[model samples]
Target: MSLFQNLKSELIRKPNSGKHLPFVDGLRFLAIVPVIFQHANERLFKYGNLPELKGWEEQVSFLISRGTIGVFIFFAISGFILSLPFSRENSKLNYKTYLKRRWQRIEPPFIFWMTCCALILLVMQAYPIGELLWHYLATVTYTHQLFYQEYSIINPVAWSLEVEIQFYLLAPFFAFAYFQVRSLAKRRSLLIAGIFGWILLQHGMGWHLQPWKATLLGQLPHFLVGVLAADLYQKPVKWIRDFRFWDLVFSLLLLTLAYTWTEELGKTFLFELSLLGLLLSAIYGRYTSRILSLSWISIIGGMCYTLYLMHLPLLEGYYSFIARFGQWSGYIGQLSISLIIVLPIIFLCSVIAFRWIEQPFMKKKDQKSLRSNPIGKQVLSKA
Candidate 1:
């Protein structure tokens, strides 16, 4: 069979959207795998280990820069997913339930992971219990970035978690802003104009730390694209479903040219636009013919959150322990061995955490409250 035929067959195998969107789960698979590869062997790719004209020792200088694109993909995916439920027919989507659901979904696993990290440090006598607890508090509250340069923050992967939490907190306000504009056509036009304007504004302003901080003009467009994708999904524009591959191919070529020039900001813009097109293509099932849908990849994608949270610290610990071997073959051998050891460990840890910890807390209906002064349902319901 042709590759497209194989891809179509695999996509058809997935259960339809009584659950989540299958193609999106597949998209998550794509995003998370790149992240893992980037984290694990980005150094190798940097030094030109993979197939190319360059020698291994003279690896490209800008390979780590691709990690920024991975992060943008993540932000865009999130903005789309988070906006999905709110854009539907249910005008009175209860904010309290939304908040509670988000809390239950996020807090338990995070707290568990942070506490586990603290306990490990304490037992190793690397830190006093008091200092560990403070670190734990900062991480649990998603303020780790604010204290990152100072405290013994456990999971640096969590910088994105801080962003995700901020998105969640501001979701209601964002929704309010969207709905306040009564005209749908005008709202969409405004969104289109805003997307272009934000990119230009960032370019005009240059790459100062201040725009990065505001994130409104910098990261907001990616997030807004995702939000707009969600809106489009609920009430799709028919022509979007007919989006031609040649258009995306042209976009991809433009993206490659930008990357080749080492234009970081231009790459971000091109990459985000390409990702947006791909996401729309996936949603409309236009590119269903191109998916591999590997069972192993889907399984790992399911555990991506856990792997994302744990991989860095786990890899660091592994690196420290491996340095004792002293006389290693080379970077390739070291990276391959490290990946072989780490992938299985990351998978196992994520599966166990998802089953034993994350699942119960994220039940559709809230269960019995665990705390004496649980953040009351009323506030949570507004979420």
Candidate 2:
């Protein structure tokens, strides 16, 4: 009993008592900034017409392309975090309750943000009101990804949300499957096989799926890696800590190979390795590192969702303005100046959105849900 108490104390030192994991938040920051940089790079390159300017365009393009790895990180993190709430109890989680919570958590922010985007587009006369209304409703339903035509009309980042929604829908089934497997090794084997089958299916069906759509299923491996990592966290695997350096090294090598190969399969393969390494590294590092544990990153990390949703609009406007009146001495100059002004404004907007929009709605929903549960009261009484 004393040994167990000591072990618990050693592991319980995470800031905020593990309610929020800083390394995961740091991963969020990593995912979001690269995505933003990628979008910004896309805009700059298109506007610059590939003119050389201190080689900034090339650098931005490289970083932006790599940002797709950020999506993998997001998926892995989601897989782990979403499973956390269910880990403590042996009570067969009420699927209805699970679905309801998922819906409430994701829908409000998504609907609100998409509506604002649609309204902006309407006011700008970007599309007809009749078509806008149709697309708007479709996006709200999270069915926009099903129809190829519907996708072009809405926020493009939502393509990932579409896949994420599918994962959420299946989480209950996944949890049930995990619980049914009495042996840890068997469960891990099943997950690995499932991921491999998904990849092969994507490859086999690539001819039928539009290239982008084909690439969409490629994200499943990363999500599975997250689930595996979560399982590892619940049951400590001593080898994970010992293998940290190798994991990091191999992950980097695979990523480099993927970029050099530049194939769809290459991207998918590297993403999985990078994500698994990232999780292991975070765990081994004690969730604190000079590179990722800084205050600014943690703060920005909190606002990642807002930043992701709003960046396209901000970048579009910024790009339009720059093209109209600005030309840099070279590509580098243009990119530097553009990023200098736009990044801070985007950051500021993300903070405001988090405070005024996301936080308020999240607080209301959580409070209402907590009031409705009252399970804590029962637990406390027993204690």
Candidate 3:
């Protein structure tokens, strides 16, 4: 195939595939870009030697500080996607197969990039081999967040993945339980109760837990929001599905409230609600935002996992190189230079990683069946 055709194939979804949601991919892009902006802004402030912004610029900076919001959106997307399989009527879920697929989808790229980061640390003599070995072990096992107060020595982003893995372990049970409820109203009530309960627990009891926000308990509400969205998507109501301008209006209103809220619980709750509005608008609204649903945007969203994992390291490395080779300019000039040089590099690296490292390990139906029934299938074949 020609390059254009190949790119098209990758970007465009095959219609009626329940597994593929282009709008969700677009949502991923939205979530990840803010994260990139957050890191970029930090690097610019640290290394750019720019004069501090006094007025509007400072306000803009504060807005970008909301980059962690991307992580919340990601958790919601995870909940929605994972629960989707279980929410369908009469769906058969084999735990062994489900876990195997989850591992295959997540582990390979994570391990690959993590090992690369560790090797870089070794080469730079950043730590003793003995210490580095322990760090690597802790990181790969997703235990670094529990044991250490700081971000992972290998990759700070891995902290979120630890939370994600915890949810992965619990999601099957949650999905199964959700399906057992017969009445939709009761199900909605339970979801609402769970959301509020988690909020209360996080605010009330979380003080006793160090680094509470990073733990699964504190983040459970965000994932639960996604589960609710999944439920809506699976059995969509016409009122939600029919596109309306009010959906966007309500979403923006919630987002504004989230931004204004001083308390963590309030901010998180509002932000999650805003994300739900956006998700609903994208999925059901008659007039979906073209920017969000565009092919290129969705493709970027598809590569978000790889981009998120690698961007910080790449930023650090680029900053180090520029520091050695160049002199600092004003903020605008520095930011412009960094954007011109770094953004393309990040995009290129992300594309390569997505194509080779991440994509290869994604669960294909044939591979999944083989993995799930390896010995049984082999014996049958022999017979």
Candidate 4:
């Protein structure tokens, strides 16, 4: 198969698997693009600090400030996708297999990039070898988020990976508990209550926990919202699916409201709700936006994890090379130039990483191939 075809097959939901949802890939695209833009915006602001573009910088920053919301959307998507298997009737839990699959999917590219970033930082910053080793260990073990809250030692985005790992470990328990509740109404009610309780804990009660902002407790509501979304996906509500135009309208409205809320609590609540609305619209609402449903968009979304991991480092590298030319006059010129130079590089690198480093681990064990080569199969199976 051609590369595009391979990506499309890998990304699109298989028709036979009821859990496969193509629109969700599109949603992933939506989540990752903002993050890329946000990082790019930060780089542009850092390097293009021209006096002429001061007013434009503030305006652009405000617009892209919500890029972090994409992370919340990602958390919710994780909750939804991970919990989906359990939502089905008579789905058996295989803890060993689950962890193995997750490890294969998430770890290889992470380690590859983490090592690359660490090595680059070590040489560039000229840190002691021992200190660099410690930093590497902390980041690879996902401990950096707990001890080093200011900045990730290697890759800045790995902090979110730490949070994601926390969720991955607990997802089975969450799924089990979610299934124990017999009634759908009660399940939804409990989810809403959990979200409210989380809000109260984080905001009203002032209970700040370890790992600070990256703590699972602080982000639990978003994941719970995703769990709720998974339930909705399995047995979609007629009203929600039927409310096409209004669903889009309300989602956009919530997103707009999100801009006004500067506080973490308000921002989290509004953005999470907005994402939920958009997700529902993408899944159930009859009128799907052509932009989101496009094959190329979904393809990019499929490569999001790789894209997210690589974009920042690539941006920093690109900026270092381009900064010598000096800043462009206007915000548009700066943004356009940056995008033109940076985006293609990011996309190309992500695709290469996805194809080689990531995709190999995603492949299912080939029993036929294994049977043909007994000794090699034994080694592969053990691996």
Candidate 4 Cα errors over 4 Å, as ranges: 1-19, 52-57, 205-211, 250-254, 257-261, 264-267, 366-383
Residue pairs whose backbone atoms clash in candidate 4: none
lDDT winner between 2 and 4, please give it.
Answer: 4
The Cα RMSD of model 2 versus the native structure comes to 7.3
Candidate 3 lDDT over 1-383, as tens digits, reads: 99977976764433222235677777788789888888887877766556767687777778777787788778888888777766776655566656766676678888889999999999999999999998999999999978886578998888889989899888878887897787888997899788877777777886315576677876787789888988888888777776567445745743563384345666656665677776677677554656567788878888788999899999988876676645566555776678789999999988877877777665254544744553212211110
Per-structure clash totals for the candidates: 11, 2, 2, 0
| Model 2, span 45-104: residue lDDT tens | 666554544465565566556766676677887777655444444525456555555565
lDDT per residue, candidate 4, 1-383, as tens digits?
Answer: 99868766765433222233557777788889988988888887677655555776777667786688788778888888778767776555556556665676678888989999999988897578888888888898888866666457688888888888898889877886797787988888888888877876777644334446676766777788888888898877778767748545745744663483344666656665766776676676554645566788777887788888899999988877777777555676777777988889899888878878866765555445434432222212211
What's the candidate order when arranged by decreasing lDDT? 3, 4, 2, 1
Clashing residue pairs for model 3: 243-285, 243-286
The lDDT values for all models are: 0.59, 0.64, 0.74, 0.72
Q: Regarding lDDT, does 1 or 4 come out ahead? A: 4
Highest lDDT model number: 3
Q: Candidate 2: TM-score?
A: 0.82
What lDDT score goes with residue 147 in model 3? 84
lDDT computed for candidate 3: 0.74
Residue 299 in model 2: shift from native, Å?
2.4
lDDT of 1 by residue, 1-383 (tens): 99856644432312211243445556666666656656666534433234332365335324433444555666777777666655654344455656767776678788888777777777888877787777778778877656654333565566667767777777656755675566767877887787767777777776324325423334667677887777777777777766666334533643453363233666556655666676676665443524524555554555456666776666656656666656355555656676788778766766666666765554445345422112223223211
